[model samples]
Target: MVIMTATEPATAGTAQTETGTEIETASDAGTAPGPGPGTGSAPGAPAGPVRPVEALLLVDLQSAFVAGGEAVPDAARVLDRSRALLARARAAGALVVHLQNDGAPGTVDEPHTPGWRLHLPVAPGPRETVVRKTGDDGFDGTPLGALLTDAGVEALTLCGVLSEMCVSATARTALARDFRVVLPHDAHATYDVPAAPGIGESVPAALASRAAEWALGDDVEIVARAAEVTFTAARPGCGTGSRAGSRTER
Candidate 1:
């Protein structure tokens, strides 16, 4: 990940998945760095030409996970930061894609159910739209990859719920696709893991989120705040930076 400042050094540790499976990996729990000079614009500032056109990918920001009484710890903060990013991305004419998860029948986020609805209102247009997925990875069986490619999106900022699940899975694929992925430290969250027999005590949501981000390796750009991320309009027909059919990690 691109450290915005010298003060913010990256850190890594072990973490567990939602299924109680443990994975020893790198973690980035520290405050993320901001964009380097000329790489991003301040809120309401014109997008800089030097930065490649970028996109904003909101993964599973559904009401089931981010709203009401069942929300994750610090859900309010995640929502607020995500909302701020959406507003700024819209103002800058950046490509915004909201990945909505369609939970199975009887599940909290069942299709067309209240909990399945998106927490934030979507402004559907050529630049902004929603993609529904049935899995943790947004691009697994969705048109997300095509959409990004058609728009010539090279870099993207990812935010949303279940830091170790949908959010982390999607980010991993985005990185493999060679997208310059930027994950704002405060814009994503997950539920506190329940204590397992002999595994360990209950893990805090904050720490799980950190472990998830850290597992993405060092290809992603971890920013301190959502406001620190900037966007540029997608350059249609310009082609994407994706390494098609290649699974090599950067």
Candidate 2:
């Protein structure tokens, strides 16, 4: 796994860190119970008929990765955005899947290590799915793929720590599997690491954002922020329409 640090100054036209600030604080913005199966809406609008998305995949939002001391830089800044996405997803009735990186034994992220658990403030809901994996790619050797297929998901909205590592890998895997991927760049973060092990090199945020943009290709859509990503009521032929139901986790 290659750890790259980002040092580009926040610039105009780039994904802004506060894209979802308004939605995050609006008290009226609660999870809306989606329309039940067989009930469809007009096409192309917010109320348009949407494929039943059974899950919201969150990558490596663990304590070891987000809290101070072991946290990713700007991790705190992104929590509200992450939480806002989670809330909207739940309202639209998508399953919340939390992915945790399990390092090799004796490492910082090993099972039972402080770093292995998810960060505080955002807890998993009762029906949420939590999957643990020993590799950077959450789907590698894990049941994530099967669970998603089983739930009949047609798309995936991914967010979490380390924009260049697990998030990138998981997005690639999802695309290869033919699943529509939605990635909001501002909802993710990464740490600065010396590019040559000992030598300093900053992984430009533009590069990270561009990599995410490229990953989607003609199939994926990159939204500027999580709030811009629409979540609608599930309709029939789309499988189960329950909000906050089962979804694939990464």
Candidate 3:
């Protein structure tokens, strides 16, 4: 993938791979400090371009979801993709939010517990917003919606743990709230689940992810990978900013 540097051309020519990572560099982005995951200029969103109201929402990437503990199946895969998404989002300077489950006290997700903390791989920066919740829907009774509104985000890119649960709930709520929602196929995941007495002992993680993807339906557009996703940096009144992007979207 070709990264955009401070003095480099940031128009159409630059690009990333299907890995879903964005550009990164301290020289670009004016003053975001050192280079982070996707911390660089945007190709589709050139400097002085009209910005779009979009953001990336990462949900339930808690330590509890990692391997061991209260683990989610295929968690390593989910983490890898999520990290890629996060780097790209940051590189694009897109609004990003990290939602974590504040499980009931004494549970694995209980607040401040070792297992309740965000997994290290998905850690947020000082400027990124972290929204804590006890419910599946990230927007339910949380500051999530308000934060998105404040950031002028009209579209939300969803990724994170337990694709069948929190990811599903948040996508539905985001749609209900009228924000365009995108679920990158490889970006979200869930564990193998126990089946009913008639079914069996376990349901494949891939199967669960597919079910959630289907349940999200047409309302939530699905992309095959993270690199194809992009955020708008410029909106009509938001000044000539850039927006996010995706390979799947027109």
Candidate 4:
């Protein structure tokens, strides 16, 4: 059952405040230093002329969702990728927005619980903005749209959990709002539980991947890897920037 809801504007200045800390503050813990634009090796795959991305949208990377219970395959891997993206966005002077899903009573993401908080391994800069969401869709009953608009974000690079649900749903909504949607394949993760335990026919990753592919369609541009994206200042009268070629894997 799909749930459709009206989109609300995100709170003004929802971006977080910088803690006056340097990028290397937590670099010792397996967090790789992300290369700056024009510094890193280009993605081997050919892509459209690279345009600057104004903002990075981190969808629901909460601890409750990515931990040991109900864990998605390669969740840790995606978290690492996300941390890299966060560093890159900060270095590029782009806005980073983190979304958190607050689960209802008795669910894994219950409020005030450790699981419901943003996961630790993935560190968001103190200045980055974070929004709390109660529903599956981040845009519903939340100020994500407004926040993006306020930040003048023309393109959105999305990564997070539950590809088929919140991630996919928010991507569709972003496209409908005329925002350029870029889905980094390896940047997001999800878990699929079979109806029956021993059925031996469950392929959650494939299903989630397909759902993301289908929902995005032409409205969204699928990026093979985060390293391939280039962010720049938005040019006037350009009606947002352009993205190269179709989606390819890293």
Candidate 5:
């Protein structure tokens, strides 16, 4: 057997110690310091570059979930924020995707029903895409993943209705599929679910949002306000970053 000894390649910043041992010099110390206390990514969020993707996923923002309709609590506010986000994304030429929930015949959100349509506040443009799904996860039985994949989307910003249900489900599934997820705290909403027998009472709208934010943990990046959101294309080494807004700790 030929035993070949390998020597470490010397770097310009390295030096030989007094004992003749190779050592890293002060100039070779390339450590990037971690964020100090109170100066880092949002609570529970992992730190990274956080480059926004071209894709903006507005999940379950159906007409039925708005005010004067089926009513997702505080839908008006959610709509307002979502509308602003849509405008910003559109102006930036970001690809908009609306997720619609389909229900059985004669029920809300049935095919062709008004309830099944995307809300006007954040309606998709003629060129924007709409994906319909029967399950809470938008990718379930739908071409959502294919659409995103074909479009070369790696990171996604999420905002829409039913924070704890459809939005949460889709976000989790997106993350599972290796897509970076971003959550603007002001851009999503949910309803208060009433308590059921043997089940805990439904949390209030505000609480539900907080819970979903916390449940999403460090995987979903939370921005303080929707206005702070930027729909820039994903840059290399981007995922999460130092948050400029408060994180939902629930």
Candidate 6:
């Protein structure tokens, strides 16, 4: 079952990741400093030319879906891949958006609950920010579309949890909007499907992930590994240029 539903205060603080890069909360969006040049090389920067004006969309990598015992079967790999992808994007100065889903009351991801928090640390700033969403589609009622447009994002590399729900729905919309979408095979995951009368036997999470990717159609560039994806900076005047920065999208 795809359980989709799911901010913070102003004056957000920052913490250092293992590598010492400062990570900020979504509340610091727009107000935090933008990335400086000469950060680091992208994950696959040497293997290929840096792609142009691309964004990184991380969907619902919340603790409820990617951490501890309740996590997806492939949660470990998803974390590793998403972390690498995030580092690469930030390093190359790409726009990075983290989508957080709010679950209904009594659910594992109920708003303000421990499980509802994002599992990974976000580097909120001009080019990187978080968007809280209520529906499976990240852009449904959020500022995602406007942010992408304002940043002049022509393509994007997307990764996260619940491959069949949030990931699939968001990707579907990105395609419809004509964004060159790239989904890494190893970066997104989901839980197993229990046996049911209509579906018969249970389906493993890995199979389900593949099925979700296939359903997105050929326009979406599905790659084998997350590392194969490269990155580039968002266009000039991206993060600080519009109303998207000053206001939170509900």
Global fold similarity of model 4 (TM-score): 0.70
- Comparison by lDDT, 5 against 6, better one: 6
Give per-residue lDDT, candidate 6, residue 122: 76
Candidate numbers sorted by lDDT from highest down: 1, 6, 5, 3, 4, 2
> Which pairs in model 5 have colliding backbones?
50-239
| Candidate 6 local lDDT, 1-250, one digit each (tens) | 1110111112243333224344553321201111112323332222233234379999988888887889999888989999999988999988999887777899987766777877888767888887777789987877788788788777787899889999999999887776767777789999998999976899988888878876776466656667667898767444323333342211
The TM-score that candidate 1 achieves is 0.79
Steric clash pairs (candidate 2)? 5-192, 31-91, 32-91, 38-236, 54-247, 64-115, 93-243, 93-244
TM-score of every candidate: 0.79, 0.66, 0.69, 0.70, 0.70, 0.75
Off by over 4 Å in 5: 1-50, 121-127, 197-202, 233-250
Better of 3 and 6 by TM-score: 6
Q: Which regions of candidate 4 fall more than 4 Å away from where they truly are?
A: 1-49, 120-127, 196-200, 233-250
Q: Find the number of clashing residue pairs for candidate 2.
A: 8
Root mean square deviation (Cα) for candidate 3: 13.8
* Top TM-score prediction, candidate number: 1
Using lDDT as the yardstick, the better of models 1 and 4 is 1
Considering lDDT, which of the candidate structures 3 and 6 is the better prediction for this target?
Answer: 6
Instruction: Please list all clashing residue pairs in model 1, or write none if there are none.
Output: 1-218, 12-27
List model 5 lDDT by residue over 164-244, tens digit each.
889899998877777777776777888887888898976678777767766765556666556656685433333222221
* lDDT at residue 8 of model 5 (Cα atoms): 24
Model 3 whole-model lDDT (C-alpha atoms): 0.61
Model 4, 153-181: lDDT tens digits are 67878888888888888888877677777
Writing each residue's lDDT as its tens digit, candidate 2 over 75-104 gives 876677788877777787675667767678
